[model samples]
Target chain A: MSRPAPRVVEFFSGPDDLSDQQREILRKMGERFPELTVDELPLDSDKARERGIPLAPGLVIDGVILGVGSVVSAGRIRRYLQPQQE
Target chain B: MTEAPKRIYLDHAATTPALPEVVDAMLPFLREEFANPSSIHAAGRAARQAVNLARSQVAGALGCPPEQIVFTSGGTESNVLALLGAAFAREESGGKGHIVTSAIEHPAVLGACRFLESRGHRVTHVRPNAQVCIEADAIIEAFAADTFLVSLMLVNNEVGTIQPVAEVARAARERGILTHCDGVQAVGKMPVNVESLGVDLLSFTGHKFGGPKGTGALFVREGTELRPIAAGGKQERGLRGGTENVAGIAGFGKACELAARDLEGNIDKVTRLRHRLIKLLDTASPGRLNGDPEQTVPHVANVCLVYVDALLLMLNLSQRGICISVGSACASGKLEPSYVLRAAGMSDFASFTSVRFSIGPSNTEDEVDEVVEQAAEMSALLRKVRTPEEIGQCDENCPCLWEERVA
Candidate 1:
């Protein structure tokens, strides 16, 4: 069976806001889930406000904010997406 | 199976690796001689003696009395103490005193001024001239009848442009206004004599000069009084009140001794390297070199590259084992353009494209050449990939005007 379409997006003002560890985690996620779509949102963009995402780093899975303002590990992301994955 | 790449550190402005001599000086205090300097026991006496010796060493470098050196956590605390302390003392004398400072001051000094303003103190922020120098005349013009203090940095943290602190101090002295100099970037990189600068107060940090972090000092001239901002113990002669970082202070003293000994040699070597790097950048690509190259210190080179993102450039440099920083490290990770570069007359777009490469004694000529080559390669690649709309021309008066004309 084919995998479901990728539905994870991260909204960040800039790469500087992401710590080294967080960037590494995202790299691993890209390797593990090639379908992941990373989106760049300007801090003052209307889409970010419409989505209710913060100006800082905010991770969304399936259009829901899974983590905000902190580095969320890949392991935790996998767990959060378990239902969808299964 | 590949070996790790050898890193070339060009970010001495951020922080430096502790010198071996500094580590050796601090080890004893951290291990065998660990004791509270404030205590009355033998071990305490030994610690106190070490602290006293360090004080004298710093005083020797700064050309001030040992008693005038008040140790604080680092540059931030020292600057806060100087601004708030002087302002409070002025208010106590029955006047709502004002402060005059440059827009290019490090956030430590600028933030303190902001705090003071929040508490009702008036402040005037002077702008730098086209050369990125905070002209003494501009500072003097900003002075008000109630202006009690003028805080200016000796060396701008981003551009390394050395201010005319001595001239400004002379101008302020005639008006009976106190002067404070943030010498965090200048003290070790250049020859700094507090007496020669003629400022009423001066701040210096340890890590900037090869000493351990968490160690710094403020030189309060004799008869210059400041109300204690961190009041508790009678430490630092009741001006700064906390048990000092004995090990850090010891390392600071050793660092100062080393800096003073190597001052001339370091300046000569770094100046040559800075010129070579600037030349390389100019020849390799088209970019605006920020700040007055002649007026700035020999250690720093800020460049603004059109069509290149500063963040991407920094990351590419980091991946290539080259380490540098964007603007002040304290203000790094913020999306806002550097206030320092902005105040120096760069538009927001130009400020966002700028990167700072601060050289140190540890950097070699070969490394300088390597960085230049890599920067050129990266700039070309980024420019090719960026869309036309993303690339914009700089203001007409950019420092690279001559280079543009030549190109």
Candidate 2:
């Protein structure tokens, strides 16, 4: 049996100013757990508000708020996903 | 197990650790000497003498006569009494009067202006220039025939930019307008002579200069009459009436004497720390200083770390055993961007990203190095989530400037 990939969502407060960075973060993450899924959304969307996002540049991994108001580094995210890959 | 990081205090502008000498001076008043200064008994007389001696010590520091000093609770109360007491007395004599003040003043002054407005008196709040220094000429220009008072800070608390106090006082004096200087930040740090500054009233507090908290005073120039703000027995010359904080006042007096002693070579020491922080912050954030670099005091360095939220940075630094603040620690529990930066005409991004790193006389070069190294690390990690080079430039209409977004 195969395990499900942890859903990753990155939310930015205003405009999607960090789209390029998210792409870079995703590409780096893909190198490790290629099956991991990532979603980029504007915090203005109802989806982010439904999750009770506290600050901009928020990260939600598998419905758990990993961090807000800062970027949880890509290397750390890779390490976070490695166990799920196993 | 790892060792806990050594704590480094970089928020002296907020409050300093009370000096041991000051604490020792206050111990006697706090304990055995429980008599009120106003009482006529023997212990009371001793208390009165202590209060009088503190007043003289404070007066000697400010270069004013002892009778001119009216001790109050702290800086905020001193400022409130100065603004309201003077304005009300003037208004009672001649119909309601108007006031001219800067927009970037501490909440104490701004809140008092609101109170003055509620009582039907008008006030014009002038904004600072790009450098965050309130212009004396601009304040003078805003003065109307009905403007009877101009309340300006000697040193802006957030940015530590010394205002054009003497020049503005001279100009206001020419027009017979009373000038009130909020000298809270300048009194113990620098040479503060009320006569030389040419201001009719000035405010100072002890905690800001390493004394006990809840101790402050106002310098009311002779012949400058102010109606009493607090109604009580004729303590503080009937201006601010309440049983005095005997211990705190004694500590404040000691703090003043110590400040005067330290003033000889203190600026050079504090300035060295400030310059070191500013110079090294360049490699950390590559952002500019928030206020006028040349016109600022030696004790503060309000640096902007672009795209980094100041609140988040402050939290990270706190966890690392490094204490810093965004703007006024008075507004703690509220995580809004630096309004002083906004008032100084910076972008919301700049305002939100700037952290005030205020050094004190006791801070060392090693501490500055550690702070900059920590700041560089945190800011680098915080900025990783942003794509500033591509899509970070924002305008007023930019959605990124939105104060409210996620529910």
lDDT of 2 by residue, B1-407 (tens): 86767999999888998999999999998788878998899999988888999999999999999999999998999899988998879877987888999999988999999999999899999999878999888999998998888999999999899999999999999998999999888877778999899999999899988998999999999999698888777888889888988989999999999999888688889988888888887765566677787887789888767666566577667757889988623232123556777777666666667788888889999999999998888777656544454213446632233223111
> Where is model 1 more than 4 Å wrong at Cα?
A1-86, B328-334, B395-407
Candidate 1 C-alpha lDDT tens digits along B1-407: 85646899988887888999999999999999999999999999999999999999999889888999999888989999999999889888856778999999988999999999988899999999866899989999999988889999999988889899999999999999999999999988998998888999999899987999999999999998699997888998889888889999999999998999999998999899988998999889777788887788888898877666565576567656788777623233345677887787776667766888989998899999999998888777555544325434556654335434435
Give the range where candidate 2 chain A is weakest over 10 consecutive residues by summed lDDT.
Answer: A11-20
Clashing pairs in 2: none
Highest DockQ model number: 2
For residue A19, give model 2's deviation from the true position in Å: 21
Residue B63, candidate 2: alpha-carbon lDDT: 91
Candidate 2, CAPRI quality class derived from DockQ: incorrect
In model 2, state the lDDT of residue B389.
41
Q: What count of clashes does model 2 give?
A: 0
lDDT of 1 by residue, A1-86 (tens): 88768766755554554644556777788777887776756645776564544435555555544433346567666655555567
